[model samples]
Target: MVLVTGIVYKQVKEQTCGISFHRDTLYDPIVISRIRPDGLFASSSLAVGMQVLTVNNVPVDDMTSSEALQLIKDTVGQVSIVAENRTIAVAEAVCVNAAPLVPESRQKRGFIILKQVEKSYSFHGPMTHDMVNLINNNLRQLKLVHGANMLQFSLNSSGHFYGATNNAAQRVHEEDFIVIILETMELLGWCLKVQYDRSPGGWQKELFVFHRMSE
Candidate 1:
């Protein structure tokens, strides 16, 4: 993982017990260097050496990384991301693979994670015990979503995860494709949104399914 430097930090304050309190602050924005091949991390057009200073043309200095990520999620079509200290804009692109898993039906259920920023995709078919173990094993190495029984994990190549859909996360296999899941306030980093056609059967009527990726 490539760490972008030049991050500035300061301190903030609070009041309690008729006294004032201050705490050191940490503000660092997450930028993508690559995308997870089979996960919600989709293909991006952002080139190497590009420093992201803003999202959708908004300067990021005053906003938190999460906030900047959300701004990216809300935009579409050649969304702008600036270089770290440069005044020029960088290129932005995204791509998704096909998925092997079929939409759930009968008693089966399906889940996905969406990037409110670029709306990129990664789809998963079924979660197995072994897959869960593998994801847990590499949790620390993973950029964004990691841990157990993840219904959905969203992150760009840069490794920023904002929220989860089901909250029950499952580990993903190297070949399994998965979808991006999300909503308005809880935009999952810098992807726009998950877009896919629906299957004819399975799943709850109120829910929608997208083909995130394929192995």
Candidate 2:
């Protein structure tokens, strides 16, 4: 996203061809990732075992290790990367066709939280920080307040970034992720948050949702 510190539509001979928008970063070569469940397009760049620590200007470093992990799980969308030199504009993020969960799904929905216990298959390029940008950017588009629980989501997200790892079998660490599922007993009309132990090399299970129940 292109960020102009000054007023909008102001003429800057330097950015002659560019027009300013709001204070937010704007994209030129807008990039989008693959679509995942919940109408979100997950980032193709995101890989499992990747640890993200920040989004845009938001720093997750100050957060507890557990808190940081949740942020990525909850967000969906892309980010804007402004070149230091202002030579170019790029929306480097995971783009999604994201929409709100359907009423049926929401009624059925709940939340889950996962912690990264291992950093097994780190990609050659793009660290968790890069993925953070993508995650944060995606969240911005959704207009959702993703705090520590940002990435704390359902089982659908597991395989998306998992297969990309070369050593998929050995990638995850012991107790790498704490899996929690929110299941809706349709007959009972109540949601159940089921906590499970995620084995080192296995993926999380299905539909049981993971959204937090509000106070």
Candidate 3:
């Protein structure tokens, strides 16, 4: 799962290759979040979602994002990078299940069913107004919204809600599960869960779940 690539860039002009990195915690491996289209790594085998293992022959498995960036910045001439491809790791954790047909009445009641797939993630929770708004906003930003029933979204390795889309007809209710089909293997990170209290002086509680799908 380890991949090696070389990137040559002017150190004087570019402090670090046009790549953004993210890590969930200090012990977590630094993951490539985004790559600039004009950057040196764009044309290389390096890609987003890959974990950084070393930079310029220096081991970075235990380094923070800042430390890794600094190492890359101090390198001269051509910089060699070693990364770990997590596709296989993600594939091992995926569980296959049969697809279910959701009726219109069930959809209105916050029931959602996705197409059958070899790789997919299912999330169970109570869908609230705030959750709906968040999903709609993210989907709109990613431009994945097409109609009332179609929805698509993606999360980074750190479990950050990056993209999502869902129409008004489909609502999420308590104990309802939403299944998402994965186009590519991805490391499932912690996802945010929200629950609202319906009693007097109601309050909302937030929870985090690992290896779960986001709203």
Candidate 4:
């Protein structure tokens, strides 16, 4: 569970919170389904897919969507919320034989962590297209594409944008972070901050944090 705190300010005199929620059923937790890039909740740590657990110290795990909405509406200025950061794990076998083979074992596993940020993505790489294709293909096999039309990845080394391409000499050592950008019709743009790592046994695992990007 994660604690997210932010002020709920009115934008353009509209009472809308600039955030939307969804509940599959009364038994299910309320999940953040959509968020505006410039909305009140956008500046906070909240992100899509996070399950809303409590609103202003009131637990809404078992409440209906209307009940949860009321709790949020009752707030005057600052709002405090507790949510769950759900992680999706992809098994190693899913991409054992993926293309652009490396010398090490191809066995790998990963987790997707959804979160939000803002950035531009016009950097060019000699092999950027190939890298994007490889990652998207893996995402498709995991059934996590979710309508994302394009994906671009680059290495973030000490705050600088470094393209993660298919060059044989280029290496992503342990503790390196990769910035992944996803574009779609619905959400427009999203960013995935990935930390690449390798286990002592040579197994690879990537931790992906998803973020909503502003234009």
Error of 2 at 7 (Å): 25
Q: Which predicted model would earn the best lDDT? A: 3
* Residues 36-96, model 4: lDDT tens digits: 5545687888766677888877888788655676566556665666777664222210111
What lDDT, from 0 to 1, does candidate 3 have? 0.43
Using Cα atoms with residue i matched to residue i, what is each candidate's TM-score against the true structure?
A: 0.26, 0.20, 0.41, 0.38
List ranges where model 3 is wrong by over 4 Å: 11-16, 88-215
1 or 4, greater by lDDT: 4
Give per-residue lDDT, candidate 3, residue 116. Answer: 14
Model 4 residue 155 lDDT? 49
The all-Cα superposition gives candidate 4 an RMSD in Å to the true structure of 14.8
**In terms of TM-score, which candidate is strongest?**
3
Predicted candidate 2 versus true structure: per-residue lDDT over 42-104, tens digit per residue: 222332222232433455445543333233333333332121123222211211122323334
Rank by lDDT (best first): 3, 4, 1, 2
lDDT agreement of model 1 with the native: 0.30
Error of 3 at 41 (Å): 1.0
Candidate 4 structure lDDT: 0.42
* lDDT per residue (tens digit) for residues 70-127 in model 1: 4533343334455443222211212222122223332123443322222222324333
lDDT values of the candidates? 0.30, 0.25, 0.43, 0.42
